[model samples]
Target chain A: MKYDCDACGPELGAYLLGESSDETRREVDAHLAACTACRDELERERALRTALGDLPTATCPGAVTARILAVVDAEYAATRRRNRRLRGVGLAGGLLAATLAAVLFLRPGAALRGASAEHYTPEQVATARHELIQTLTLTARVLDQAGRSTLVDVFNDQLPSAVEGSLRPLDDPTRGG
Target chain B: MTNETFHELLATHRDRVFTQALFSLRERRDAEDVTQEAFLRLWRQGDHLPADRVAPWLAHVTRNLCIDQTRRRSAARRHLGVADADAVDGLVAAAGGPDDPFAGLDLDDRQRRLLDALQTLPAETRTVMLMHYGDGTKLADIADAMGKSLAAVKVQVHRARQRLRLVLGTADGVSEQRGSA
Candidate 1:
């Protein structure tokens, strides 16, 4: 007979654990009597179990509970904060985009307005200038100090005395055409 | 249960839980943490179970948590530079007290080598063996805590013991096992 190790297997497991019943005990003993291999195997297993069982149980670090709970709480708080910040960021981004879109659409005139209102077509600009020179003599004046200096130097270097004198009328604050 | 009763329950089982984690994870800090967490879960789930179920429930939850820690430790050991992270290895390497059964022996190296081999076992098998040997929990209790069928737990334990036999080699002077006929 290919020796019946079936019952012996669990018996050995129980024997190692000291939980073997009398029936398992008797059966395994009977097998051991007839089988030297099984007998030595049983002895070996029993010794191994005893050795391991005799070893002291290792103690976990003293502060393990507090540390684990602390880590858990920190992780929980971090998750909540991340969710809140994500919500706030999402709300802010949506509001900003909507505001920019509203500005562009509601005030197409502002977005589409030309460079300046005084800008005119080439012929219209020339005609207006000619009319101004012939009649009321409209002139552009530099109000700031740097602009005034630049205008003064440019006029002195680039224009004749009579033309410069003609430009003097436009310096009055009340002058317009 | 009343708050006082619940607090009493926690105080009563705290040591058992702590000791179990300590032995299973082989790290004191981790055991204490697992105990706290297990008890906290017990408190949170207090309404779900009756008072009598508390200890067994605590054992179950704590065992699971320790198993998780064991799995994490092993996985961590598999990564870079953590060879001794396994609890068994840590115990053998730094566990030099006279209290250690393996500390003084004719075959000290062999004992340590056996422990190191046991350390490399899969977490589930190691946990079963630890509960079986270290905590002295019965196969039935270990089976219940491990959520395994009694027969399956039996087989698992046998395998663990057989491997232990092979490693320790007739621990304490019986003889090496003869191959099965």
Candidate 2:
């Protein structure tokens, strides 16, 4: 196959880099043989590659390497700590859940006995109900008194100043006159 | 690979990654930061990565970090009037180093011209070129890392070579004329 320079121009790097397939290499070779421009271009590419490839390998500073390792270490440690905390929390939660489940399943009557009517007789139940009502009524009275006290304080704080301002004239002429 | 082998790989490629970042970002501190980020990323993902993909993976991550840094630098420049003094100082310092790869080599006139010309290329082009030539990374790998098509990378590389050749050729002609005189 005949090779055109325009078509073959882009393949030059591939050819020099040995990335070109055999067939493409042959095509490039044929094109290069027939074209001086491409030939010169190829030589220049070769020179550039050689010059660039010959650049000495540079090493990162020792301190920079140490810093990188330190950062990685710190980050890894943090990750481990986070994972461990999560695991601890998860394990504790699991244990607690499991214990509760086991107790419910094994002593099925524990929940019932705590709130069961069997634990209290009729007289004791009536007395307990009466005590509960009394406690609730006292609590309600205390809350109502607290609310009234707050309102009284607010009114007392504002009333004297409000009355004084209302009785006083807006434009006092005694001092100015 | 085990921790030992991973460390070995890190030691082996440390300079390559640093040099690539240094050239790409044009600042030593930024390069170091990018290098650290890349290695840290590698360590985190190392277990899931294939052995062969390690080097290119580092290259890809480092380049991305450099690009991000460049964007940040530009933004900071715009908003805070922050200039890249570090980049200039880094190049100047690197120019004097006896062990600096770009400077230390006993290159000929043409090679030196090529090196100087390389600095003048766009950051992305110079990066791809350097990674390919300096580290011997494949174009396809560079493309994959940079999220570019292979063809695009090749084109950038081609343009870089073409520019360097022209610059070197011009320098060669002037030197030849002087020699003849």
Backbone clash pairs in model 1 (N, Cα, C under 3 Å; residues 3+ apart or in different chains), count:
9
TM-score of B-chain for each predicted structure, in order:
0.60, 0.69
What are the per-residue Cα lDDT tens digits for candidate 2 across A127-159?
A: 445434433443333333333334343235433
What are the lDDT scores of the predictions, listed in order? 0.58, 0.67
What lDDT is reached at residue A67 by model 1? 58
Give DockQ: model 2: 0.21
Per-residue CA lDDT of model 1 for B34-110, tens digit only, reads: 78788767755647777656665677788789888777776777874565455656676676732433222344454
Off by over 4 Å in 1: A1-3, A15-25, A58-177, B1-16, B19-28, B47-60, B70-115, B169-181
User: What is every candidate's C-alpha DockQ against the true complex, given to 2 decimals?
Assistant: 0.15, 0.21
Highest DockQ scorer: 2
lDDT of 2 by residue, B1-181 (tens): 3456667878888988987887666567787888888887788785788777788878777877888999998777566443465565577778983244444435566655655677788777887888887767888787887888988887888777767656666555323333232
RMSD in angstroms, all models?
A: 19.8, 17.9
Candidate number with greatest TM-score:
2
